[model samples]
Target chain A: MKKNLMAVLVGVLLTLLSLSLIEVYYRAFVPPKAEVFAFVPSTPVEVPEARLSAELISQIQGDPIMKWRSLGSAYEGEYNAKVVDVSKQGPLGCCVLQGFFAPPGKVHSRAYTKHRDLLYDVHFTFDQRSRRITPEVSHARNALLAFGDSYTLGEGVNDEESFPYVLGTYRASTQVYNLGLMGGSANQTLYEVTKLPEKRLPDLPDQEVTAIYTFMVDHLERLICRSLCLTAQGMWRLNQPFYSLKNGRPYFEGAFSDRKVLNSFYTWFHQSAIVQGTGMVLPPQFTQEHFDFFATMMVEIRDVLKTKYPKLKFYVVMYPGSSDPYGSDLTAACKKRGLNVLNYASVDITGLAQKRERIAGEGHPSPIAHMILARLLNRDLPQ
Target chain B: MLLQEFWDFMRERKKYWMMPIIISLLALGFLILFSQTAVLPFVYTLF
Candidate 1:
């Protein structure tokens, strides 16, 4: 009987061991798709396609070159023929720029950058020209400065379709400068504003730069702690040629320490399939510090910009993420500091769809959400 | 006589029963830690 019991125990143990191995293998190999992360590019290339019709290619080639705004694609042909770096196209293949071709009326443009890959697509005429916000008009009308992460820079959206661009289009008289950069947190936002040139300050009509919009999501809260995770040894080999350790850890030597890169890499890794699939939830303990830092930064930015452009209006556009319970708390805190708070809950986003077919998924506010914000800002700005 | 002998054998092995109790306590500690640190915050945010 004892021998039989021992056999049963061994069988159970073997089954459990096999199950654990399978779970680990599945996570490592066939992990679920990352929902919110964008692709990072490995190299940069520019390609011109002659395969398109002579008329279309001519239009593209002839269009006066606009200042290059980082890495993005443009479309020219009927069916919206997309022009992108041939090498930067994703594993699923590059978009056929031809499908989006239509006479420009109210074109919807979206831009996204992942790793080193950048995608910009223009969707045609979902609204009228009056509904569109042009930068020229915005400059003519109000003193506008946009602050945020990559989304404010129109990541996964087109330069013209970016919120700043849209705001510019909406208010032809407003002067808008997009001080947004990818991977920027609230502290970085404050730093960027303080670093802006004085020459740029005089272009605004109001000595009080009437609007300062800061975009934020929960991910910003993770930056400091993650930075602490980088090790001294890891810092040494950040930018050198990539090498794998015996345990299969990949290392690259770069200007930044290994710990910095490792922190970002691990953060990105955890933020990818497993954590995102479960809905990008962060620990609550971080909420107070996150809100406090963000609020402090906003106040500092407001005071600094106010020193130069004293009449500056300040607002925070809460990036869409359901992960922070302190969301309401943050809004209330912002109110205490005399800043306008645009929480997702306050907006009429009911009309906005959540899928790719209608709106960008994850925490990204849909185009409709953008419209709501634009309208609110237009109405709220002190005349 | 056989029943009395079996009772005597059971009494000899009482110390072995403490092993399962120790494991249960360890598992309860883990459960409490996970609940407070990760699970509660997630639930609070969702609604």
Candidate 2:
């Protein structure tokens, strides 16, 4: 027994020695990089690249649940476009109440960098009544409602370059609402279409419209609040609405205000790769239910949207390509629930990496790609 | 000189416990050096 204990102790010592060496190697060779921590942003910091002013960036630092009161925290006006100030805003609610993330009549203008490190401007405008990003057209014979995360929101592109806006250009009579929330998941997109106020959802079927939910694999992490995608200076975001699966049915669990523990853990866990690869991650509250919940929410959104536009055709468009393990499952789920699904993996977004059509610093769909999707949608959307 | 003497003493006494201690100290020294470079971010990917 004595010999055995010594042997075991020696073995442990060896393992410790190995770890120590590895840690040393990491320390000796690795260069420090600007890393994002998984904590909810507190303390305003200057993001020189962002369009907002430095003073505004410093003001919105704090626990997100308490800080985010309204949609536009900072406000500025330019004849070029209506800009909503978000320097004071932080992570938003945990669950969707109005079936949307922002208030009505809001426009978000941001500056981003593309592949060559060249700068570009992007804008998102929400309609006055529906609160969705309607096309710039004044009068349209019909409308298209689109939703997803940043890519759908035209992350590195202008408002006119978003897929919804380009789709409106394809058919002058159709007004498209870009309901793509900045950091949304597929389930969150579904919630935005289904959870809005009664008056917000138009039940009358006077207009011919199409509702498309655009998604990418990256949204999976956002779906479960497993990661934080940097939005702006001092604007680390992940605190959107979350859902709970009870008795196999998905229900809203509330916003960041309601999920302090989960939010806090994610806020911390996302800080470093050391934290992530070391199993310092939080256990997800539910098994991968985004597919199920997404399907359910899409069905509900379709039903409610159908009440407004009789000619509405519901579609789930996977944008910037779909490479997630859940992509197929999401497609299957959407199809099983009677929603049309389109996989846009064929677009040669080589420009994204080459910085041709996409911005050099950010790898989101460029205006060229948005136009490509618009043309594709025009060809494929059910007439 | 003390570290060399300590190493000699550990070898003689078979003080395996000191291995972890020494390695950890060396590791800390490495971290101090490596943090100044760009390769540090990739270290965490090793799991």
Candidate 3:
């Protein structure tokens, strides 16, 4: 027994010694994956084409770029400090506290690509209620509420060039509310819309409303706290809003990390060198259940909006971007729930100059692409 | 400097068996510490 114990201890000692040496070599000599790839010239990223075009053509189209009042330079520190609790004023709210929003004012910042090319140096203006400013022409009785991730939030572009801004300014009688959050998911939108009647959404006028949700393929992974989503996005998703279906209804389950087992496993998995170094993800194949869950969330969101606005016209616009295997399954599931889907998956930018529809040095859609999409959506709007 | 002190204390106490365990723990601690500064940011930027 004594000899066996000694042998085991020595084995552990040798194993640890080998690992420590490798760690030293990796840290001292090996460059990060990003740095190593930076030397190679980057190729244009593939964005899937949108097939369906808008049918109802309107003559009231203008330049996607509009004007905004600048409130000077905004620092990253000050930007994070201006957080408002959109949920129940707790960490467990339906929408987690997004601290990166500039408080109720126009803030300017610059974005640079890895190649040192200036991508954008623009201003972002927030309204008095801390929403991204969308310029409205006239005080119209109808409302347009936009929701989704950064594409809907217009991350890389000026406020004037965002899809919501283009749509709001183009339509004279509709007031546009930009509920799109950067890196936001259906969880946030569901929570926001559910609480709309409670005055949480203070400025929304009670009238005919049209809610547009810009769907992305990756949102399926986000809906569930997938290992890839948690680790790749880092600590941000720790406090990300989590929801689960109970009796066919979506229930808020606090933050993603609030799930004790998943949080601990992913927290350890992210720190594990083997996982990080190789970029291997867990549950390598997403099953049909994942797609169904995502579609269920959309159903809940639709139901919430319908309860509030009886005449609400909800459109799920699948933004032209990366394609995934479960796209068809997800769309089918949404259709089963009687949701209106404007699939722009085949929206062709092939005729345009290569990469013209995208922002230079960044992957987000350019103002030109936004113009195309806005015009398509304009045709579908009820004037 | 602290590493040297730790080594000295281990030698004085004649805790040879503990040396490997301590080295293993310290090495892991050092690895994780360096990873946070060197690796995590690069991984995050990919998103």
lDDT tens string, model 2, B7-29?
Answer: 78876876756655676566545
lDDT of 3 by residue, A76-166 (tens): 1111111223332321111243423435776664555444446566667777655678876566778888878667777657887888898
Candidate 1 residue-wise lDDT, A36-87, digit = tens: 2222111211111222245633332332322222221221111212232222
TM-scores of the models, in the order given: 0.49, 0.59, 0.67
Over A1-383, each residue of candidate 2 has an lDDT whose tens digit, in order, gives 57545754785678666655665664566443343211111221111114333442232222131221221211111112112355434112222333334555544544422222233444445555444454565666667777666667665465566777767766777666666665566556556655653533433357777788876655554455443322111122334566666765557776533566755655664444332232222333223366766677667667766765767788877653332334566767777878888755433333222223343333445555566567667767854
Per-candidate interface C-alpha RMSD? 13.8, 13.3, 10.3
Backbone clash pairs in model 3 (N, Cα, C under 3 Å; residues 3+ apart or in different chains), count? 9
How much of the real interface does each model capture, measured as fnat?
A: 0.00, 0.01, 0.00
Top TM-score prediction, candidate number: 3
The ten-residue window of minimal lDDT in model 3 chain A covers: A74-83
What ranges in model 2 sit over 4 Å off? Answer: A1-87, A90-118, A122-126, A130-142, A198-203, A227-237, A256-273, A276-293, A303-312, A322-326, A351-355, B1-47
Task: Indicate the residue-level lDDT of B15 in model 1.
Answer: 32
RMSD of each: 16.5, 14.3, 11.4
